[model samples]
Target: MSLSNIANDPNKRMILFGGKGGVGKTSISSATAIYLAEQGDKVLIISTDPAHSLSDAFSQDLSGGEVIQIEGVDGDLCGLEISPEKGTEEVKHMLEEEGVSDELNQSLSMLGLDDLTSDLHQNTPPGMDEAVALSQVMQIARQGDYDRIILDTAPTGHTIRLLSLPEFLDSFLGRLLKMRVKLSNTLAFFKSMVGMEAEKDRSVEIMEKLKENILQIREDLQNHTETEFVVVSIPTLMSVYESERLLVALTEQNILVRNVVINQIMPRNESCPFCSARYHSQQEVLEYARQVFSDYVQTELPYLAEEVKGVEKLRKLASMIFSDA
Candidate 1:
């Protein structure tokens, strides 16, 4: 589908841009947010990467829970860099406030298989960051105030987890919740025989909230036709391979991928060895993308003089992306 087809309508809340690391997913996602905001929509640009670059893209310090508005954009352009560390902390705080002590909470969090899961995540693996970051996005969506929500996701592995979340957690949570209820009832019966009341099931409350969030997202994704998935990749072997895998995964989940953005294609100007080699490599990858993905592919951003970080540079980058050349 065309940009006009997607952007003209404001109801499309979840616009996702994802692909390999350093493939310009953030830049394109930021540009799309800026472009949409310029069109008079209230746009919230969110970075679902632990190592966020949205602040760098906007040339502003956008930390904390506040939404910093972009100056020049006609409509609302709020930028957020989600902190998953904050998310985990929030969950911990909620548990604590509900009378779960620091000691008990720590032991509870540490005693389960979740402790091993914590170790795996603490290693700073690629996809774990994305999974945690996706929760941050869901939190923003839950607020339900924005005209559009643009998700600038982490690399492919993380993004794969984020997209698969609906299917991945749905059945998993269902079975776990059932088992928890059964076990809780069994424990309650034992406690009654001993003349003691059973412990309240706060676990059920938490699961219900989580399930609510997941189901709401699933519904938003299913019905929100304006929600589009844009993939960004450079014309290189590794990026091509990663993008293809992501596409296949999204297809399997029945997610609609609207565009494949090829970032940093080598320009045909210079005859330098590096540029020439990159040009040839990009040409091969572009051919592969067209054959495999066809019309879903849209826009090729050329290599720039320096990495795009500041707002001025990002504006130039945006110009090129939205340009007809």
Candidate 2:
């Protein structure tokens, strides 16, 4: 099974593991990152889910802003959990620079806007996490520090917002930036008349950088060779249907999704009626997935006897998924 073309395609720089919540995407993404790192590729795994689980999957505290090197992995693997709250703080700090914070604050204070823009992240619209996560991807990709980037994305609905955000955010931000530039010009003119120097247009700088990142993100994500998405799901009616919706949505966005992971496939216990019935129900969904999702490569991950945590378990999981090559 071509589970994200990791072993097969050397050109794919970004791979995203996403699906319904609690579908083992974190485990899969961490395993894949381990696999690539062991293969001598510098790999970084990032968790975009606000409910970060990379720490639990690897038994480490990855909730911090800095990238943490994963212990006990076979190769060069580092992990980061990017939080929207953290991104917002970074923006606030940029706006309030060293030695400039006091003056900038006083200026805005006189303008009677300091209180409103003080905690900027609070006023950000809904789904800012998705936008922030995508921005992180663009930032990382631009840096060229890692050979491969493995993303453990949010659940289905939020992930859709992330994948489709490039174009929508690009256009929306474009218009917004235009209006802001006009306002900045007006402010600059007024400042000149008052015999005062105009404060630097920091928002324009940040927004322009964001616009550039969004455009690059869109181009890279749409290119099949540069990016791939693996949908992780379980053999159940609800999860399977949602996986189908995720697949269709990806196709519509022109993002590449060449692999489907059907996690937690259970075995039948002949003596227990409940086990047998559950297996039957799961089998039906498996077969349905085989037909509807036939266009992409499909792989089955059996239900683990224990939680797949720490390095040993993750390495084992990686063997099962990527050992096909």
Candidate 3:
């Protein structure tokens, strides 16, 4: 498919750009968001990477958890850089509201067990950022406020971990729920002997809600028509290898990959030995990519003299990527 096809596809509300670092994923994602916004659609481009480059790409100071509207765009274009630390804190607050922390502390105190409330406040579990980011995406998708949601994800490994989280969490939580059920039954048996009632199953409710959210995310991801994964890479052997791995992983998950963008292609210059050598090597890699990913749409972006920073440069980049050229 072409950029126009992606732009005009009604079902493509969630577009994700991911690949190895230094491959111009941020540039492409930002340009795509700008292209969509310029086409008269409201777009929200979010960076889930801990090391954010969206603000740098736009040449604007876009820090904090709030979304800031991009000035000068004819249509609505907003950007958000998610802070993983802040996201973990938000998750803590949500758990507090759900009474998870309170109930766990109370139950542990009664049983003379080690208190986990302090530990929970001290540290967020590993991969919490991906979990929280997924939740944020789900929230934005459900709101229907923006015409399109473009995600500039982290490097290949991190993005794959994020994509696989729903399934991992669903199964893990299922086991936890089962254990909680057994615990509840045991507690009820003891309470009955003393003619007292067991407490309500708040843990069960929380786990069930957690499971439900995971299922919702899984459904949205598996809806191939509505979600498109755009893999970005450079015209290099290593980049092509990583992109191929990403394609296989996404295919295994049954997620749809609409495009593979080969960025930073060196222009042919036979007079310059250095450029000529690089161009020839890049051609071989490109051919390999074309053969490997024959079923998917592929696009090449010429190497620019300067770095792609600021809205003007991004607009120019967008034109190149989206145009029929």
Candidate 4:
């Protein structure tokens, strides 16, 4: 359904923002987080973009590795910026500490190659940062402390790949881990007969742990009540088209998609012919988006005079979202 309808749904616990780059998804997500916090909910906002600007949005430095609180909200309003490189390193550290050799352990570096993992990670495709983001989201959900979780996701194409990762990884890793375990056992038996000990494969063990994490995220997505995907787009032909395809992809995955947020609409400026013409052009694209998406559409946010940054500005945006003014 439309963003307005979904936001009105009290049972929805997670709100995700995704769209083409520079469509104001981050601003909308920040506003939503602030609004939820004002409504007496503990809200945790996360950014999956490598070039994260949540700290800029909040006017505070929030690059700490964990969830950090935003000072002004009435309820819990924490922010996290996930670095896939960092997450990959974290996994590698675990593997090495567990005693895998440098030669064999280098495979752990695979996790750092997001571009290489794009095809596999498309449905939760492997090695991409989106997987790290999803896992982080799952961790927050499992903790069960926050009333709401808002994610300022990457562009639509990337976000879709991330969302699909859980299922794809679940099946892929499950079967692979089983095979690895069997192979390891067989190799150990052969080494015993030769009077030599077989060393453990730390890479395999790391994969197994990642497999478990994927399974849990898959479970969380399936539950539906706790997670929802929101697609944000600008009032432009290209953005709308991308979002249309993204929606179809999500439906195929059986993922529960809640709303289509149309952001950064040109405000009516009667005196400026350029502004008026652009507004009319946006209106046409907006109309097309509504017709194509039907009930799933919501109006875009008007361009503001000043950049939306800091808790005070975000609160104003939250006000605008809920109010006519």
Candidate 5:
């Protein structure tokens, strides 16, 4: 499929740009959002990476949890830089609001669950940032406020973890819920034998709802018609290998990769020896990428002298990425 076709597709509601760091994922994601917005679609571009470059790419000072509209754009284009710290806090606040932590603590008090509950709130796991970010993404996607939601994700490893977190959480929660249900049943049986009434456990209901939300997000992610993954890489050996790994990981999770963008291609300027040598080296890597990702649509972005920032530079990048020529 052509770049224009992918960009203009009505069914493509979510677009994810991810690859190794320093491969221009942020710039490409920003440009794509601009392109889609300019086409009259309301677009919101968000950065899930803790080290946010979306603000830098757009030359705008965007804060966490707030969407800022880009100036000089004819269409509606908003940007957000998700602060992982803020996201973690928000997740905690949400659990508190839902009384999940409190309910679980009260229900499991017999088993010394206070420590576990404290650990949950105090000690976040290694991939908790990504988990929080994914939760935020799901929340935004469900809001239906924008025609297209563009995500500029973290580097390859984190992105893969983020993509797989829903399944992991779903399974983990299921097992926990089962255990809780069995324990509740046993307790209720003992209470009935003693001629006492047992109250319905609300923790199970909360777990069920959590599982439902996870399943819904997973479904949305796996919907090929509505979601698209774009892997960005430069013409280099390491980049090619990383991109291959990323694609394989996504494929394993049944996520459809719609495109592979090879950024920073050397121009065909053979006058200089260094440029000539770099071009040849890049061509070899490019050919390898073509063979490896032949099943997916591939596009290349030329190396520009100036760093791609601000509206004009991003517009030029968008044209290069989506242009038929």
Candidate 6:
């Protein structure tokens, strides 16, 4: 399960890095994206985290939610930071496209339900941000612009919601479509009785388009050969515990997870008593992780003296992770 496998596999189009924050996820994911791009694969490394660090990691600004070509790498690499506002607006715009909104409004107006339009815009779903973020990236994958996409997600909670969102959204929208269909049917019965005509089912049209957006990502998510979730955690108790819970949740959602990176392992130093003590302490946690995540490929990253901030430093980190490749 070397990352070389992901870089080489035609089906492995997406590699998602997720875990508790501050576990070196941003650095690791960024480095992996660079490594893949360096391998002659066009790569897009995007973050859906509200608090974005891609700009810092890449030493460039990726703010504004627009894709920017990364300059320092010879390999093709692009970056984007999906803000909550952008994600919400993307979903809103998707729903409103193809005259769906006009038809919806016309139907509502005909049914004497113009008030529901305001409610539709006001009502917010739980994972609207995550759902739209995923939808946007998946759309790119389906379009085949990049050979691989490295998804640097928010913390574990948000990512878990994202994995589960497709199913939840499907169910949610299915219910709304059902209600709309029933209401329209009822109206049709009355209209027939009055020798009038029933309006077309615009809700069905809208829901179908929304459902199409999730289909590709949802299928790729469950297909382990197509996508993989890499869990990153430090050699600490709390991170280990959270990683375990995250693993369970990912299992529940049927998302594929094959790699676990134990970042920031302290190196032994006999001269420094503190380093020696912490090094031994970290080994215990590492051993626990090796046993707990034995089912997955494990990579240990030694604590570095310098921050993994620049392209060269990121290259160093990537070598440590994918030296064999």
Return the top candidate by lDDT.
6
**Global lDDT of each model?**
0.69, 0.79, 0.81, 0.73, 0.81, 0.82
Off by over 4 Å in 4: 1-8, 99-127, 167-186, 189-193, 200-205
Q: Please write out the lDDT profile of model 2 over residues 92-197, one tens digit for every residue.
A: 5664553224544455566665653443434554455666677787688769998899988889998777666666656656655665565567677988999898
**After TM-score superposition, what is the CA distance of residue 215 in candidate 4 from its true location, in Å?**
2.1
Model 1 CA lDDT for position 224: 40
Candidate 5, residues 1-325: lDDT per residue as tens digits?
3477677687899998899989999999999999999998999999976676887888878766688898877799998888877777876676667665454576566666555456556775445677677768879988999999999988898877766766666665665676577667877897899998976555557656655765677788889998988999999999999999999999987888978999999998789999999999999999998899898888888999999999899999998888972
Query: Which is better, 1 or 5, measured by lDDT?
Result: 5
**Stretches of model 1 off by over 4 angstroms after superposition:** 1-4, 72-75, 95-139, 142-144, 166-175
Cα lDDT tens digits, model 3, 121-220, are 5554445577678778879888999889999988898877767776666665665555456556767797899999866646557757766776787778
How big is the positional error of residue 291 in model 2, measured in Å on the Cα after superposition? 1.0
TM-score of each: 0.83, 0.82, 0.88, 0.83, 0.85, 0.85
Task: List the lowest-lDDT window of 10 residues for candidate 6.
Answer: 98-107
lDDT order, best first, reads 6, 5, 3, 2, 4, 1
- The pairs that clash in candidate 6 are none
Q: How well does candidate 3 match the true structure in TM-score terms?
A: 0.88
- Compute the lDDT of residue 194 as modeled in candidate 6: 100
Angstrom error of the Cα, residue 84, model 6: value is: 3.8
Lowest summed lDDT across 10 adjacent residues in model 4 is found at 115-124
Model 1, residue 127: what's the lDDT? 37
- The deviation in Å at residue 53 for candidate 2 is 1.1
